[model samples]
Target: MKTLGVIAGREMRLALRNRSILITAAIFAIWFPVMSAFGVVAGAGGDAATIAGGIAAITIPVGIFMGYIFCADAFLREKRDGTIETLLCTPVSLRRLWEGKAIGVAVPAYVMTLISATVTIAAISTIAGITVVTEPLLLLHLATIVPVWIVASAGLIGAAQLALGMRENQILGFLLIFGFIFIIIGLQEVAPGGPGISPVTEGILAVAGIALVAFARFTAGRVTRERIVLTIP
Candidate 1:
């Protein structure tokens, strides 16, 4: 438990220091929300559910999506620089390391996601000339569902980075981006000529998120230092 916390803390500090991570965080935290609000502006104005859905559609994905955007190199970079070997020699178990790194990547991104969601809601409501009130389902999604998604996403992707080769990891990163993009587009389009994710949709999101968490745990059990080291370039 202490080892996991230490690794998570170390990764958080490293993420804060990384120029690319900061830049990416800034872009999504500042620009993506405004852009999404604009994209869905027509239906979002003065509708709580629409507003909440639009906000979730954009902001919820920020944490999980950006988790990989930043952690695509979680193990790949370590391997490239010969640090994976050092980590392998450490007393930390592979599963613990995987969980720690996932939490490390997910935590900061989750904070940024919260900030982005708040900013988007405020900006969108102000633009629409109305009070912003999130629907219960949407609010739940932002507060609970999104964070779960982030954990699941980061855990799975981080584990894969350790288990897969560099080329495979790169390919996985691309696939994740594309898949999220598709989900975003689909959610926006399916919101009934508006911006809200319905209760039913949010339910689906919750189920899917839980499933992903289970999948990540399954993947974590399969990660081994030998395979990670053998595949290192």
Candidate 2:
């Protein structure tokens, strides 16, 4: 537990020190929600359900995107510069290291998600001249489901970055970003009513997020130092 904290703290410090990454992430985190809220307010007229649905739609993708950005620094950069090899020589298990890294990344990413949600609510309220309150299901999605998804996303991406060559990781990164965009577009097309933030949808997404986290853990466990070393370039 102490080792995990130490590792997590290290990653957090690294993330904080990287001003460029922090600035980029903050911009996206703030930009997407504010813009979405504007569109929703203009079209939907400050309907609470519509606001909640809009928040739900944007927050998850933004959270995952933040995780994706940090994964490059947390996992890929270490492997690229050979620092991961030194960490591999330590007493900590690879799984713990990966978990710590994921936690570190997820914490900030989730915070950014919260910021995005808040900005969305504020923007909607400001534009429509009404106070905004999130629905219970939407609250549940933000409090639990979104963070879990961030961790799962970071863990999965970190595992892949550690196990793959630089070229492959670059390709994976591109695909991940585009994949999320396509998913959002598909959901909009399939459910024109907006992101349906019902109990059933939240429940299914929660289960899927948990399953993805477990899968990421399994994949991280399978990563060996030799495999990472061989893949480094």
Candidate 3:
């Protein structure tokens, strides 16, 4: 656990030192949530909670996708800088190191997502002269689903980055970005039809979230030190 903390701290420091990454993260983290909030409040002619829940269902994925962008360089940057080899030699096991790296990015992204959502809610309330969102489910999402989803995504992306060569990494990065774009588009198509928050849907998402984390853990285990070391140019 302590080893994981050290590894996580190192990743956070790296993220802080990269001005471009920080700026990009700031833009995406702030922009998407605010837009989603205002759009839902203005357009959705329904209960505030229901509208917020619908907005959240679609927008939360945007938050996770933004988190992925911030973490896209999680392993690629290390490999490019020639530090991954040295980091691999540290006392931490491969699984712990990878999980920590993902967690490090996930923690900050999740916090920013929460802050962005809260600020939007407050803004809507102030402007509309009514509480725009009082959804317990939206609260539940920010509390549980968002964090787990971010961590799982970062962990999987990190593991894949460590395992792939530079050319492959670049190709996949583009694919992942476009993939998220399509997902956002798809969400927009369905949201207008008014997706209900059935208990079954929530259950499926919870199960999927847990499965994603487990898949990440399994992938981390497969990211051998030698494979990563050899992949370094």
Q: Indicate which candidate wins on TM-score.
A: 2
Return the lDDT, model 1, position 161. Answer: 81
* Model 2 stretches with alpha carbons more than 4 Å out: 180-194
Q: What digit string (tens of lDDT, one per residue) describes model 2 on residues 42-159?
A: 7666577766766677788888899998888899889989999999999999889999999988888888779878888788788888665638877888899889888988998899
Number of the predicted model whose lDDT against the real structure is largest: 2
Candidate 3, 1-233: lDDT as tens digits: 88889878877777777788777877776676667666666765546765665556654575566567667656778888888888877777788878788978887777767777776677656555566455676667667776877777777777878888889888876675455446434543454444534344455556666887898899888878888988887
Q: Give lDDT per model, in order.
A: 0.76, 0.82, 0.70
Model 1 scores worst on lDDT over the 10 consecutive residues at 187-196
**Residue-wise C-alpha lDDT for candidate 1, range 70-137, written one tens digit per residue:** 57545457777879788878888888888888888888888888888887877787677655553677
Q: List the lowest-lDDT window of 10 residues for candidate 2.
A: 185-194
Residue pairs in clash, model 2:
none
lDDT of 2 at 148: 87
| Candidate 1 pairs with clashing backbones | none
Q: How many residue pairs clash in each candidate at the backbone level?
A: 0, 0, 0
RMSD of 3: 3.2
**Deviation of model 1 at 211, angstroms:** 0.8
